[model samples]
Target chain A: MTADHLRREEWAVTLPSLGWLLALFAAPTLLVFAVSFRPADPYGGIGAGWTLATLREMARTPLGPVIARTVRLSALTTAICLALAIPCGTCLARVAPRRQAVLLLLVVVPFWTSFLIRVFAWRMLLHPEGPLKRVLVTVGLADPHTQLLYSEPAVLLVMVYTFLPFAILPIYAAAEKFDLALLEAARDLGAGPWGAFVKVFLPGIGRGVLTATLMVLIPALGSYVIPDLVGGPGQDMLGNRIAQRAFSDRNLPQASALSAALTLAALAPMALAALVQRRPPALEAAARKEAA
Target chain B: MRRSRWPPVVTAAVLVFLWLPIAVLAANSFNRSRFGSSWEGLSLRWYRALLADADTWRALRNSLVVGVGATLTSLALGTSAAVALHRHRSRLQRLHYALVYSPLVVPDLLMGMSLLVLFVALGADLGLGTVYLAHTTFCVSYVAMVVLARLQDFDPSILEAARDLGAGRWTVVRRVLLPLLAPGLAAAGLLAFTLSIDDFVITFFVAGPGATTLPVRVYSMIKHSRNLPAINALSVLMLAATFTAVRASRRLLQEDRP
Candidate 1:
């Protein structure tokens, strides 16, 4: 009725894995964190000496506006992606099983190609004389040459397109595992459809929501590609701004400061993911397994 | 529950909407006279132009080097970690698993930037090597997570039986462990290749003077001239190549799915 206590031998196999991860993955990040506190070059005050100036400088500058824009765009993208994905997952989960698999494959088809090509395809769509332009002109929405590329809306659209798969995949996983009877129970207990969903179904999808929000938020925020090319020159975000300072401005100090800000910002979702995964349900499963 | 076509209808519509830009770019690639989208007639002239372009070749080579290099590194590091973790159940095993998952959670930009700083402080030359290191750091974790998921139901008893039947650790591993884990390893490796080839953010941050990737080149072109036929042709070519590989990988993984 139980695993052999001689399973102690298994511990021998697993220890080195912890060592390997710590050495390779954890060590590198530790190095990054350590170096972040060091001065990039010390011309401003400490003369290439150690300084809090970098961390302090994070709050200053048009950096606030820059980061705010990045967060806003990323949040909007996450909301839109989830908004589309939730119903999409519900559809897939509730559909006939054979048909649902085909639909899921279809949703994931775009993920089959390079992300670069997918984003580039959008370029073709929004081009001046492109089909979209032709359609718009045909329908008389705007002029033939009205620029669609390099705008905030374009950036948002690309973000949604790129991340929509991320949202759907996790939510679909959750829905597949969802106990529909609880939802029916809620409905049976004088709850309307909306109430049933809010009270019974939402909690079942909680982990999926967290995972999808997380998956969307991290990339959407630091994404240099969509915002840089699609959002254009003036739409400089944290990523674009950092790349600009590093490559264009060649200001390593400023870039270092920007990099530190980005690292802290990236930690937000990561920390939340860590917290969620350690929650009672997941931890209880692990603990129960250990007790067995 | 009554089924609704509205959900599927909306989903299909959204997908088409998503593909609009791709359709536009691909459709325009064949337009005889490019200059954005002045369609004279259907022709493969732009693809010919794409094939002939020097920068295109250079970028393609750069992307291949980065992709192959990063994939190899990730497989080596990631597979080792997955194997170790698969065998290693400890007090902090869940935390250990989450540690491997951290790279998945971090933004590519942060990883790129942090690597840039880390390499700089070490006085390491900023080049393709640094780029590979950065790419490997993030990709290895993804590979580990995927592989580990595939390992959940795997039986350790087979290894014990092989050992009891007079096999050494290496022999048991070579004959028993590797064969069972082979499909998962292949999937992880293929996924890493796909991710590395498609990567823009991390590579953008960590690449040096000569490490200009295809996406970077294409990105600049999009910024300057939004409707270049060569870019469209290149996208189509890349799409074709990726589809072929993805299909092949799918077959390889699926065949082992008994």
Candidate 2:
């Protein structure tokens, strides 16, 4: 068969799914974008008139605090996840290869449980009369009436707990390929431990750290279930507001606007990461030469 | 061997933190107390209640149907997309690969809201069917990624050899590719099914009246009622099911390697 015929045949393979994605996935997002520009009706639907009221109102009051809190919480979650994951990832990489797989699996298996269920488990454990309270009482650390279930700390705790695996897996993947001999060589050549770590260790797992940070940070920003289940009444994240507008208030136009803005904001970090991760031609050529 | 002992200790502590809540959850499922704090004694009262609840069973049934439907459709779409992308090496095709995988990165809330907008615009009633479509949309990206990872190590010479031996496209696909891809497909389908069953945020947005899923049902119950031990029992069972599904998928993916 001719090359043209082969190319056509290959194109045929992608045709079906491409059509499905365009029709279902792309079309819906476009519809949401369209709705965001429309005015809301009292009858729980959008009207034909165009208005920027939703966008304007979003800039005014709750949206600013919501976005600010979301960012603050997400950044903290990412930082804490990275701190915890890096040491654990180092340990994982240092272990025997066979044991490493088992350890990694242990980290991932808990993630397979329902996200809501895990959040609920945290709610119970942090409740006023929960195990944590009892532990604190027994240790004489605090009064018996201390409540952790509905506070900012509770939300942060659950967010970190939930996203910790995402942080660990990527860092572990990066650290697994790390070379300890380089560190030894650096030391042999007269570099201090801190110097060796900064020069040798960080660069080795830099990609993994970036990947882990983005993976955890992006989803953490969009979180709702954690705050809803564990947070106090005033702890509304951007997700909670978006979801409330859509489901509770039935304000489709405003919800669409907020969701559209949130989606755009979420896409920024992913796009930047993708750009940063693109392999350089020099590295590719070096790799090819090494392979040869 | 006088290495620092901090790594192992730190790792152990992290693992404990990871598994403690789950252990507590499972333990509390059998607690006789209404609130799952104090342990009176082991009992099956909550499980008995879980079994007797018609709403729970109905929601479970709804979850299963949605899971199966989403899994099958995702498998077909994902496999085709993976195969095509594997064969093409052009820049546009590389972009296509990125687009196919974009759903994996986009947050679920955005996916749910956008799909809800689309369905409402089309005037389709919100229910299990819409939820099925939404699930399939995201699940396709997941299945495609898994299968594509497997396909990367695949040899293309086999297809050329099959064609050289006078095999038609259909014959080559059925005789060669299908058997080779069996393990990957199984792993992908299992992953897709688990995701569909575990999904809450997406399904909750799309599901209308009389179409409450297991997760949605459980969420509403938790929101409305403060102290229900039955939920703990239900959660424990779901946890067991999730573990089984993940273990099965891991095994299938391992088998795919060879």
Candidate 3:
């Protein structure tokens, strides 16, 4: 083909993605950032004033506490999911290839179901009159629990359950790519199974763990629904507070400011996770081969 | 590898934890008990009641419309965009990638609220149509990212070979590229289906009075009453349908393995 034709074809390949990005994401995000600066009229329309007062109000409200709680809860949830998903992922990696699809589907089954329905189901499972409490009572764990549904544990449970798949996919991708020959060689040199896992396997899957952590942590940090439906009174996350500001209190300024801050707060963990996800090229290619 | 005893045991326990709530809700939907705890005996009374409830049917229909419509739009947009990105090498590809993936990182509630503001300013009317637009906006990226990952698995040499064999671009894409990408597209479409169905926050912001989805309907019902029999029945149906689809996909994925 002619050089000019090839150039035109290349441009044909590039423009649509750039167009979608410009129209859908870049413009929309700019609109949001611009909204943060526009003055909120009392009647819910933008006003002439452009000031930092809305941000100042964010400092005085319950935003600081909400942010702190979100971080603590999300961190705990991520750590727990990691603890559970890693070994499970390792098993999938080490097992027979024939069963991999069924096993992998199991990991993602919860995702296929609605998040709202799953959380709603948890209500039935955790309520005082629910099966969980009945079982606990039958087992003599205590008198049927009264506070399980709205407690911190409920929030934690949903968080972990909802995001655990994120943790598994990455870690499994890495662990499956692990150098079996390396582990075999170590075993030949008298390394025990546990020793091989620690020295050989863990480091191999570290990037996957890091990426999975990112996959879990970012969404968990700014989560809105779980805390609202399952979180106890006075233990609200920043998301609920933002919703309240916009809807109930009609305080759009404070709401926008709170959202902006929450977005800003999530950047650090996300950046750290992204940095960790950028593994050595050899490691990435290994993961891809394993995936194949 | 041999079947170890520990994995099945662990998998069983985890699956039980995962599936029990859904199972309970499904069973209780048939129970005569209003409290949702005891087995007062099986009954289809709740299903009859759900059929007569106009609001419930409306929500169900709305959700179907939204889910199917939204998924189709995303599949089209995302597939095209992923194909374009897959073909060309550009200095800005990573930046473009990071942008598409950004929606995944931000919480849905924030996106919902900011979008409400943006849409209002731009004078886009809010309703079921608006919900469709909102759903497609985020859904495109998700569908794109997954399809892109799948596209990366494909060897570039195959496309080059098709081109070198004197095939035009359209012919190569139609015959060679599209067939190979089928599994990835279907997976992306199914995933988008789940996402559209699960969505509430964005829908809540963008949805108008004429269009309430199933989740919104359930939320509204819970707000007004404690009668969960119907809710449980609906939940059961939803769970079963999604699980069946997922299992079927898994079976196909396994059989399709090269």
Q: Which candidate has the top score in TM-score?
A: 2
DockQ of 3: 0.51
Per-residue C-alpha lDDT of model 3 across residues B1-258, encoded as one tens digit per residue:
223366456556666766776677788889998877888988998888888788888888888898899899888878877876776566666666777778877778777877776666666777888788788888888889878887888798998999999899799989998898888888888878878887888888668567899888887776565556788777777878888878765554445667
* CAPRI rating of model 1: medium
Off by over 4 Å in 1: A1-47, A55-60, A143-147, A270-292, B36-38, B91-95, B224-227
Candidate with better TM-score, 1 vs 3: 3
lDDT (C-alpha) at residue A9 in model 3: 75
- Candidate 3's C-alpha runs over 4 A off are A2-4, A184-195, A277-292, B1-10, B153-166, B251-256
Q: List lDDT for all candidates, in order.
A: 0.74, 0.86, 0.77
Predicted structure with the largest DockQ when compared to the true one: 2
Work out the TM-score per prediction.
Answer: 0.87, 0.94, 0.89
Residue A273, candidate 1: Cα error in Å is 5.3
Write model 2 residue lDDT over B40-128, tens digit each, in one string: 99999999989999998999999999999999999999999999888878875776687697787777888888888888777898999
Per-prediction DockQ comes to 0.51, 0.69, 0.51
Candidate 1 lDDT over B118-200, as tens digits, reads: 66656777777877777776777878887787777577788889999999979987998888878878878888988887787
- The reply for model 2, stretches above 4 Å from the true place, is A278-292, B1-4, B256-258
- Give the least accurate 10-residue stretch of model 3 chain A, judged by summed lDDT: A12-21
TM-score between candidate 3 and the true structure:
0.89
